[model samples]
Target: MIVEHRIYTTHPGQVHEYLALYEAEGLAIQKRILGRMVGYYRSEIGGLNQVIHLWAYADLAERDQRRAALLADEGFRHYVRKITPLLAGQESRILVPAPFFTPTWQD
Candidate 1:
């Protein structure tokens, strides 16, 4: 499996606005298309105003297809428009687990 980890650094003091938007709108659209959410988190210490979320995919191909669908969704597009200005930076990484340690959760 592959894990996509996305970290969004919001404009200072805007984390709450981003979280509220995601919770009210983005989360449902994402859950409908990007089904394998590992977790969602917000930074409280070192990386203040950062939001981190993880999604697991069987492979890169599946990730691409699902992400494409998400991008096509009207609700997602609208949510993106509203949240774009609140972000300071965005980073994403695709992770491959080592043989000795793999995630136990099943999608």
Candidate 2:
């Protein structure tokens, strides 16, 4: 499996807005396109000013397809436009899961 992590840095004084927007708007759109959200977080320590979220994908191909579909979605486009003014910086990474990791809780 693949894990995609995105770390977003919000503009000063905009952290709450960023988090609120994600909760009220972004999460649902993301759930529709991305499937398997591992977590979403706001830093309380060294990564202050950051918002991190993770999603799992079957493979690179699937990830690419889903990302493309998400980018093409009109709602996502509107969402992006809505959040553009609040962003400071962004970073993303794709990681391979270790063999011990499993999608199901029983694993």
Candidate 3:
């Protein structure tokens, strides 16, 4: 599996608005294209005003196809236009799990 970690720095005092918009609009549109969400987060440390989310894909090719489909979706495009101005900076990383890792179960 491939993992995507997206980190966003929101405008000062805009965390609440950003989360609300994401829940009400962004997430729904994302679900339509991406299908499953691994996790979403708001940082309580590391200088604040940060939002992070993780997504899992079957492979790099699958990730590319799904992400491109998402960007082409009209609803998602509209949300991007609305939310882009609220962002300070964004970063994304792709990760691979260790050989022994099991994402669905832990011990």
Q: Which candidate is the best by TM-score?
A: 1
List residue ranges in candidate 1 displaced over 4 A.
Answer: none
lDDT of 1: 0.94
Candidate 3 residues lying further than 4 Å off, grouped into runs, are 105-107
**In candidate 3, what are the lDDT values of residues 1-107, reduced to their tens digit?**
87899999999989899999999899988877886688899999876899998888888998899999998898888999989999998999998999998789221
What lDDT does each candidate get?
0.94, 0.86, 0.88
Best by lDDT: 1
TM per candidate: 0.95, 0.91, 0.93
lDDT of residue 14 for candidate 1 = 99
CA RMSD of all predictions: 0.9, 1.9, 2.4
Q: Candidate 2: worst 10 consecutive residues by lDDT?
A: 98-107
Ranked by lDDT, the better of candidates 1 and 2 is 1
